[model samples]
Target: MMTILDALYLLVGIMFAATAIINLRDSLNSKRWKSAGFWGINAIIFIFGRYLPPLANRILVIVMVLLAGLGGLGRSGKPETSLEQREVRASRFGNRLFIPMLLIPLVTMLGTFAFKSLTWNGALLIPAGSSTLAPLAAGHDAGNGAGGRRKPLVWRRSRLSGLGAGGG
Candidate 1:
């Protein structure tokens, strides 16, 4: 049976692969190729490192460290949003924005206990090494949902703050 970590790793691998593709297409970044390579390697590591030999995994990690230490990584010159827009959003959201962050720990604690005895086919639901991470991932999901308009508590607070139905 696959562990929860396997699913999370696949998701992270996809994200890293997307980053690698973005870096590869970033003409403005002088080190675009290096950046792409770095992220591509990270994607491979996350996706397939478990199946690789220990020595190979170590070599890949060393390569990543060397690349980072040698300033091989770079970002595209463009940003999706400007600093001013970010500040404006921050001000617009106010303290209610912090609700998601606060819920993370609480959700993690609850999920840890909730998942502790969960099972499938008599196997432990979470891998031994990922006892903490599995619940933490669930917490992240809960936190994201907690701040949404659908939730009763946040809906009233969001309305009172006049945030309306605007996306954060």
Candidate 2:
């Protein structure tokens, strides 16, 4: 039972892996344009998909597919270039931007894990789980009156205190 966020994260991970594989294939085939285009699509997907909903995600995917298809076909019309020749030409402009593109997912995963660990104690109690410490979990106010409705513990950043506040 993966949440939407979890599924999105997995999708992003797979996209990055696919991009890396495509990059490697392009390197071996002397297709630098394909590699750059794939990398560009990867960046666009990551940024747009992370910030937008499924509708936007689908739109971005469609746009990337069209762009990649057109760009790849367009490049095939040019003169055939050797791998070394392409590398020399591309490197002349210091266009090694794709190298940092690989780190986006790595940094995202690290930051997610770090934030979860720091904020949630590395445990997501799914309400029905049998845990002795479930009562202490955030938003778990079992006997806090108000017709048994659980009240979330709000934290005041200025005072650094937890106040049980009901969302009225």
Candidate 3:
């Protein structure tokens, strides 16, 4: 029997593939071959790692871990909007910025609660088998679109990690 977990892995693979395409475009624009290669391999791994033999999966995991530890990934250098320009935008768009942020959660929650229509056979049209994954995946894709590419900063929204502290 296929489970929602299986569906989620497929969705994750798709997301990684999409990200790889974005990374490739960024690389093409900026001549960042390493960035392209990195995300490209990540896409492959996300899509195929489950199908690979255990040893191969372990090796890929090790390599990815090393690359991350060595800081092989770099950010797009497109100048972030200058703070002065940002201040102006913020002043002009005050409270509007919050709309983008709130939209993700709103859509996710709505999807979680209302997306799974009851089928004639009684199973949902969309699986909400993993309650958390449904909303999270919805929000994640939305967040990625609205947030776009920016410098790497610790995700502080969760109380898991922070400056000089373990995530746990």
Number of the top candidate by lDDT?
1
Candidates ranked by TM-score, best first? 1, 3, 2
lDDT of 3 by residue, 1-168 (tens): 445545666777775566556555553234345555565667667677778898887877777677657766555543344557556756876776566478678877886776555344676555556555666676766765564344213232111121122211
**Where is the poorest 10-residue window by lDDT in model 1?**
159-168
List the candidates' TM-scores in order: 0.75, 0.27, 0.57
- Candidate 3 matches the true fold with a TM-score of 0.57
* Clashes per candidate, residues 3 or more apart or on different chains: 0, 0, 0
Tens digits of per-residue lDDT for model 2 on 1-168? 543344444555455545545444443345555555565556666645556787877876776677567654222122344557556655763534333344444444444444442323444522222222222221122212221233222211111111112111
User: Model 2: how far is 166 from its true place, Å?
Assistant: 59
Alpha carbon deviation, residue 92, candidate 1 (Å): 1.4
What is residue 152's positional error in candidate 3, in angstroms?
18
Q: Once superposed on the true structure, which residue ranges of model 3 sit more than 4 Å away at CA?
A: 1-8, 25-31, 103-129, 142-168
Q: Which stretches of candidate 2 lie over 4 Å from their true place?
A: 1-11, 14-18, 21-26, 39-48, 53-59, 71-168
C-alpha RMSD by candidate, in order: 7.6, 21.3, 8.1
